[model samples]
Target: MYSKFIINKDSFLGLAMNDIDKSSGNSLTTKYKNIVDSVLKEKFENNKYIDGSKIQSEWFPQVKCDIFLSHSHKDVKKAKQFAGWLKNKFGLEVFIDYNIWGNINDLLQNIDDTYCYDKLKGTYSYKKRNFTTSHVHMMLINALADMMDRTECLMFFETPNSIDLKKMTHSTESLTESPWIYNELFLSKILQNIQRRKKNELVKSQESVRLYADLNENFNPKYNVDISHLIDLSNDDLKNWLFHYKDNKHQNKPHSLDVLYNLKNINLK
Candidate 1:
């Protein structure tokens, strides 16, 4: 769920990233625009998140699940079918991203001959309603917050296995990988509060990262950070930082030097 990137404004390649265990940082979906890659695509194909069919999984805890699927319109149909299956089988509520947003010609890009508006409409012809800009963004942020606030990442295992793994594996160490069916998680109820509080904190960190990025561009600050340290931060602190970073507008909040001093004195651990 966490990723550290050294982007050169071109592609995901060319970066020496750190692991979460050694660094104090948060998860990575790469960026708003570039969210996919061959490595990630391969992970999805391999279904690494799912336990083998024979492996007994504990009941999915936290009753009253309301799945919120956030994705480009290109992914709406898949999300809807997935949502419908879960709802019918388990009676769990599902909110596919399409139902919220409306007229997404702007939000989703990179489509021309391979895809078009009329074709996209046909794709969703069976479904009703689309997502609006405000609705989609707000819901996505809300859903992500919910997942992070909870103990588990609202998981679902979709890809059904052709055979049971327990029978195939004679030893504990050689079990096959099973893919997790679900995607995205709902977040905190006090999201508005957390959002505002974090907005004020992130400007500083964003400035730091941007500065680091710029330095990389001009070759200046000689950046160096271990991902393990960032990952080692408690979920709470790291999430707080994430929410702050997300609300980039709040970067201008004026925290007095004394306030920072007081914060430094407080035991974060």
Candidate 2:
């Protein structure tokens, strides 16, 4: 189950929540180096809601994807409700983990305020450089990232089940954060973002660059909608740039048959 809390504190008795946000941001800014420590591995233990799926129909015919929803059990009910919505909306078959979200009666049984507050005060692990709270958080984020990359699984926003969605809907208060989906499509999110990417990354070959450059020169409208504007990049030039290791092959790079197009057109110069 997944949920998110978007706290937009309006003028409650004339004092606004923005004041607190600014103060906290300023405090963090004063000690900016922590950004590296904090940002290095985003310790977000929230569920991820993905609006898109890389799971093509051919991948699974008999089984709908098995999604591993990881989050605090306090967030389970809302996740189930949302899962219901998802099932109704896309006719998607889903499986909710029992550990994170049990029945409502179980929720009532486990609603200890003291337990909630004390959850973070657990033991530290020198190996992981984490205490209980941070360790759990890091684990969740890593799991979420891995799931998002899967061709089938999708993680969704996670929040406590204590949140009242029906009341929230009726009140006309839009969730500012509103619990959006997170994807690693952007370069920063995956390789550089995670503690991964550099070693096994596919490098852009100079041949690919030359190919793009050459294609740009020989591009014609019959081959495309707007030939000049569309295929303006030469594949050959792109390939040359991409071929990292210099060799005898590029010694006498032939001038393109179609006169060298103005680099200024594509702003390449």
Candidate 3:
């Protein structure tokens, strides 16, 4: 019953129509559908096709960052400084919530005001303000989710204001002042696990192919000639190859924390 959209490289154009599960009524799917519809209306007005195929568009949910820095509102200044350092030191784009939401303070203030006024007796305007605030929060959450998916990795800034060291040491789940940061951390971990699972599956498939090639039906000299090179490869060499293959497949990506630490120490060229 859990509905989700699985987008692959092949069928990008049919994204909107492909996953229309009416019974689930998932808001995330609806948001994606709306975005795709808007893009199609603006970009492909003439219904243009390239090489008898639908052209892939990459404008719906814009993601131009290699890393997403999830930090508390109190750490905006530090986040900005770190983002600048990353950009100059490694030529990497960093996405910070502060940049997206110009003034978090003001936004939070408005939400507080909406909540306070909503509790007033028979306030007609309270309903409208509450709806507006809810809509804005939903949009922000959806945007963050999309950015997490697109970014290579998510680096969480664990500051004193955000996390309580005492609680962290004693309890399994440490409470944070900023709930959004915790949400981002959970989503990022899930994404990483999913990616790792996919890579493992790909490795298993490759191993299966190698095994099949080794056990050939026809042992004739002509048939065995081509697979002779494969036969000579040792188990260690095959493992090394698979390791390299996975690295190559992922384009030698660095861990988020590792990249952050390297950026902090290295001098900008």
Candidate 4:
């Protein structure tokens, strides 16, 4: 039995069998290899390049979620309240770190606290194998990447501290130097661009192709200015963007209550 299989444009079914064959007996490997080869040859002989756009469309034909709430660890309470409001009012599925990480945050907090204390006490030694810095960092990156992958729409919960830090910073470091919130924003923008590209490719028209090309010319994955401007918006304006009502005729009216009422009435499964 094949333990893992991943089909990509470059490798196809051969790569999957090769990967499994590395750890399997010759006879067992031969059995699965022949099966996979035969299946691929029979079913997918004409399909050379994997249709990434088609696969993406079939998997997420519509918006899988209403929002992905990205916020600082310090603002967990407020974020939770906002998430609860969105869910109760709009029946929207909001993805927050707490929902995904659960008790892992507590564990990581303890580990981080211990690490800091040890460093301050001059007892932190790299020779010790107790949750090294690299391990913890890798765990965080992997978890955040997974969560971000599942998010259909991303909303950053900006606070005073986040705004100040973002404004004060001016480096391109990916590690301890850059704030995690900023990294999350960068990653989200990159993911958004990728999804946009996939969706655009699915249009299958010369006009769409030209439009996509033009869009790419202006697409900056860094999104520094855009994010800063968004952070500077008032609560109502921010809410408008989140609810996608910026161009509505009632844009001048107060948005909070009205938006909530509208969402509450819209029946969403």
Best by TM-score, which number? Answer: 3
Clashing pairs in 4: none
Pairs with steric clashes in candidate 3:
none
Q: Tell me model 3's lDDT, rounded to 2 decimals.
A: 0.41
Query: What tens digits encode model 2's per-residue C-alpha lDDT throughout 153-262?
Result: 22333232312232243453212111112111111123221111112332211110000111234552111011111122233432332232222267665322111222
User: Where is model 3 poorest over a 10-residue stretch in terms of lDDT?
Assistant: 203-212
lDDT of each: 0.27, 0.27, 0.41, 0.40
Which runs of model 1 end up more than 4 angstroms from their true locations? 1-65, 103-269
Candidate 4 local lDDT, 208-262, one digit each (tens): 0000111235553322323632222244433443455434556375433334335
Give the Å error, residue 169, model 1.
Answer: 25
Ranking by lDDT: 3, 4, 2, 1
Q: How does each model score on TM-score?
A: 0.22, 0.23, 0.44, 0.42
Off by over 4 Å in 4: 1-65, 99-125, 129-131, 165-178, 194-269
Q: After TM-score superposition, what is the CA distance of residue 67 in candidate 3 from its true location, in Å?
A: 0.4
What lDDT score is found at residue 235 in candidate 4? 45
> The CA-based lDDT of model 1 is what?
0.27
Assess the local accuracy of residue 77 in candidate 4 as a C-alpha lDDT between 0 and 100.
58
Local accuracy of candidate 3 as per-residue lDDT tens digits, 15-67: 23222222122332234345544543444233332121222223334435566
**Candidate closest to the true structure, highest lDDT:** 3
